[model samples]
Target: MSGSSKKPMRRAVVPVSKTLPTDPQDQHSSSEEVDPIFFTPSPSPPSNTPTPDNASALPCDHATGEPHRHPNPTRHPDFWFHDGSIILQVESKLFKIHQTILANHSEVFAGLFDVPPPLPTGTTEGDDMVLEGCRIVVLHGDTEKDFESLLRAVYNPSYFDDTLPPSADVETLLDFISGILHLSTKYLIRNLRQRCINLFTSKFPATFDEYTAKSTPQPSYSSTRSSSHKQERYRSDTLMRALHLAHSCNITTSLPYLYYCTARLSLHRLLKPRPTDVDWQTKSVVLAGRERLRYATLAISYSFLLVFERAPTCAEMRCGFASGPGREWRSIVLGGESGIGSAPTPPTAATSITNAGGVNGISASATAERKSKSSSNRAPNPLRLYTRWPELGVCDRCVEWNKGVHERGRREVWERLPGMFELEGWDELRKAQGS
Candidate 1:
């Protein structure tokens, strides 16, 4: 490298013999006031100062007999702009980024740059250290990877864009998304923080209608796999991680739906500890919430039993009878062995139905059979929208009435979901999100 083109590495120094001028007029003319780049010997130590022989052994420079200064950190290849005005040292990595760009994006950075940085570790007050022709600032309590992610988002316009298709791998996106969310929040980068919040809420929506839309499986066929299968795989793998992120980031709007998804997880999966496992308090919340969800799902799924007055425009009177649509619908939902479209048995314990009453004058023996069959089936989904009414031998008018009632009950469940997990209502959550 050519010496002439390189910026001088300078350290601030003061003359040993320099003394304050007695006269005010002589102060400005003092020859001791030299440029910061010029090297001057330090003043001699006080008589009481420890000598090398008597002093406790310490790491020191062999040549100077002074404590060793920190080694120069390795420079980041991608982020070191030639025209960068500031250097940020995170751990053992150095990032050269434009101060104006960082300041424009984050108020924290703006205020940080407004005040002078503290003197470097070995230097006294009023001593400044310059590296690569820029002020070197040491950033504490931040990882190199996270700072890189924050810098990428600041420099690259499309870094956090939502241009990726729905089929894009989510785990890969979460890698950068998590880093950006963490650092952005710490740096007070409002736009990047909000972008992260939007991404989370999109997956775990606050509203019932939005949650339903997201939950509705849209199957895309491929040579080897279906889109619905891919989505399910993603959810099963990432739901816990996402829940932990939401809880850590304080994304209140997404917590309700995230907790709901967690509540649906099998007990084995819930209890299995992982590196990112949530706290015991959240685990307790999930357990309590699961019980609440199971009870609500059963009640909502069987709400049709309460419809004593049949639709006047029934296609057939038999459709309302115990041996007809009424009994058939109960069997299908309760997963009776004799019913069509019964769910397959889950590996876990069966969901038990309690406090259920006889429906449409069904006999006691028939009810017992229904209960017996239900005890072997998986839990009912609280968010389930029954669209198989036509296959259940139900008339159009009766189907319409039951569907309306089920939809309303599902909405009610969604509204109460947050409270089950010790969170605020949707309206309050939404307000907090906006704030």
Candidate 2:
């Protein structure tokens, strides 16, 4: 039945005290303490009958020999179907959903339903319980929000619609997906698990080329209002949560890029992580990887510039000279950290020749103009490929040679990314994903 067409139902609540035994294979065992669900036959008395002064002394169900009710809260507004065969309690919320729907999607639920309730011993209060004339199965470890997301996704086809508008709130989307992924994995719902994995991979692509292709230009960073700062904080927290989720779910392919992004966060931000931030071990790994990235930035990304080796085919004396445009370009790109004492002045139009189409097909004048405009504000992004080699005032041959060297360096860095973050190689990660 459509969720919209279903009216809410009020039912008696039964609090359960007994928790489920820990499943050796359950991923959530280490994180959440789950209680086992008990089932009992419906009580003989009508649910609406006035409670006796000593209601706690009520007799147990004759069939199962289990207590029938403990008043708490009403049924869930959306998921409580009058015809539902089973009642699931997640915290204070109660969902009267179908066993068939759950069994169709989850092997765990199917196996659960296959096992009939134990023969009642009549010794324990919670050995078996009932509510609203249906069996109550309490999910002890799960939160109402997460269980609600799972049911919503199951009952409504359009709940997790992917064709969201461009301006959809990213944080909300991620939260929804994360919650679904968690329960789906626990319940062994393969399709929903795969859907969540696909969404995560799209955001954090497994391949380097895809990652580069989707890379957004880094925004200019500056101090902002309290709201902006809060937004930044939320983004950081979300990133940390995503990293943890990827690890827990064995979404290995996304780890390197996630680690790389974590490495790029400022030291202050890293040091002052949220209380529920990625663990100390993860933080240490990121810090180590950040240092490696810094070394890679200078040693690989700008290797050609560091040595200032002119192309053998270069004819321009200005390109070949150690103190010429190459030195000035190095100073500009490296922020004068290449042993040049002070920040060298930008090359003037007189000193720089206007090549019609230089590096990456960008004209020398345009490159120079862009450089002049943003040079002061732009921070050096090590992973970014330098495409304005013509701004070095070097000849076409030297520019092409440097470009080739830079491209090779970037490819090497991509290959080494997993190692830098202490993760398995991409091939192994891909294999794990398939498995």
lDDT of 2 by residue, 29-147 (tens): 23344444333333334445433222222223433444434434346889988778776766656788988899999866775566343332222123334444445555645788989
lDDT of 1 by residue, 1-435 (tens): 687865443332322112211222222223434222122122223344332213221122323534323343567999888888776777667687888899999766775566354333333322233445555565655788989888888888887664445544557657657878866765667798888777766777877778777767676665454445223344545887887676545566788888877777666677777776765667788888877776675555445643333576776765555333444445544554332222221211112223133443345446756554554334335776655565545567877877777788888888888887788677766654442
**TM, every model:** 0.68, 0.65
- Candidate 1: regions farther than 4 A off: 1-72, 116-128, 161-166, 217-231, 234-237, 305-309, 312-316, 322-380
Error of 2 at 385 (Å): 2.2
Candidate 1 similarity to native, TM-score = 0.68
Ten-residue segment with the worst summed lDDT in candidate 2? Answer: 13-22
Model 2 misplaced regions, further than 4 Å: 1-73, 116-134, 162-166, 216-234, 308-319, 322-381, 433-435
